[model samples]
Target: MDAINLVSARELARRNGLSFPNESPEYRQARDELLAEEIELRRHIERVAEQRRALPPGGQVRKDYRFQGPDGEVTLRDLFADKSTLVIYSYMYGPQRERPCPMCTSMLSAFDGEVPDICQQVAFAVVARSPIERLLAFKKERGWHHLPLYSDTTDEFSRDYHAIGPDGGDGAAYNVFTIKDGVIRHFWNPEMGFATADPGQDPRGAPDFMPLWTVLDTTPDGRPPSWYPSLTYGSGP
Candidate 1:
């Protein structure tokens, strides 16, 4: 049996919580099953992460663009920070959009403090179409001192990677790459709940990386479809 058998999404949502659909009995049942599945899923995530680390760093992605740094402007090639593996998190900040992506921000909240340890092994950075000045200002506003933000304002790197939604539109993503012989290649790119929807089971496993799942653990009901409001500006979950 699932861990949360006594509650329903409707009941969960009643008290400032958003969860399974109130009209669908099946959605509620599936939501309950997800609780136990999530536990086993976390172990699976550990294995997949191990697999990602085992992949002898495939492909060579070579593209050049300019970026803004703490000191001044820099180039895309400089983003490697001398590491073999470069992880690029496509931030949702864009020219048309006014606010940073609440989801991306939540995923990053954990990494913000652990970046020092991560930088020692694998290099990571955040890329966005937003101007360097604008991105930096928001970083300050959010107190994100650990991340290295970059701009792809002049190049099609974001489009090439499908990081953005449309031409001059908006989207966000998590893309990883490997550089070899002055060329970089795509390795892994994971999207929210996308792996589970795959047919080949290539997604392999699941985890509570999504904030909704974590919040659901505490309540009898699960999470809501409503936007994930920012915790950076607000208090508590």
Candidate 2:
């Protein structure tokens, strides 16, 4: 059988054997329609990924930016390691702030566990504008031993990559770079930010990268507008 286009989403949803207790006909009808839409949404995600993979080569990275990692100083090219693909997450942890951005920290915390598996296919690093010691200390405090943290001490990388705003504030950025024949080039980065957010929605890239947001999006509550992740949650009455 062909990998795709085997069956229509509506047909698949209708054939589902799942039935909940005390479900009315009205609910079932609406649920079946929703399931069909969900199936279509999954297919659309795959299509978007395929197109992204087929994109033409991005801008070449000519400058030799330096960063301070746990193992000492390293260049941007050094980040590729043995892998042709490199993924760097520019976290909001600049020296100006007493603490890192909670949202960025939350996202990185989730990535900590997935680092091992993800590194199998790509070299991944979490970069910040703070000093190496501060970055490492925070990593340890977060118990993120698997994540490879780095400090963009000079702000060269962050500035060039648009990870830092013009106001000298830090922001979250996920960038992918490709290396071939000793030449490094940018691959992809989501440009969506607060400016691109719809009237009632928070700015988020398609196929959201954060697991917390993804999970919350599936619930009936559907990611409350005011709800956000916090660095520490106290168990108070």
| Maximum-TM-score candidate | 2
- 1-237, model 1: which lDDT tens digit per residue? 243464543444344333644558777566556654655565566667787668775546655656666677776667787997778877787777787778777777666777899899888888888888998888787787798778877648778777766466766667777777778778876655443566632221244455545676578654544535574555644
Residue range 6-125, candidate 2, lDDT tens digits: 699899999996889999999999999999999888888887888899999999999998999888899988888899999999999999999899889888888988999999999999
TM-score of each candidate structure, all chains considered together: 0.67, 0.94
Q: How far is candidate 1 from the true structure (C-alpha RMSD, Å)?
A: 9.9
Q: What TM-score would you give candidate 1 relative to the actual structure?
A: 0.67
lDDT score for residue 186 of model 1: 83
Q: How close to the true structure is residue 156 of candidate 2, measured as C-alpha lDDT?
A: 86
Model 1 lDDT, residue 181, Cα? 74
In candidate 2, list every pair of residues with a backbone clash.
Answer: none
Measured by TM-score, how close is model 2 to the native structure?
0.94
Candidate 1 residue spans exceeding 4 A from truth:
1-43, 50-57, 191-208, 231-237
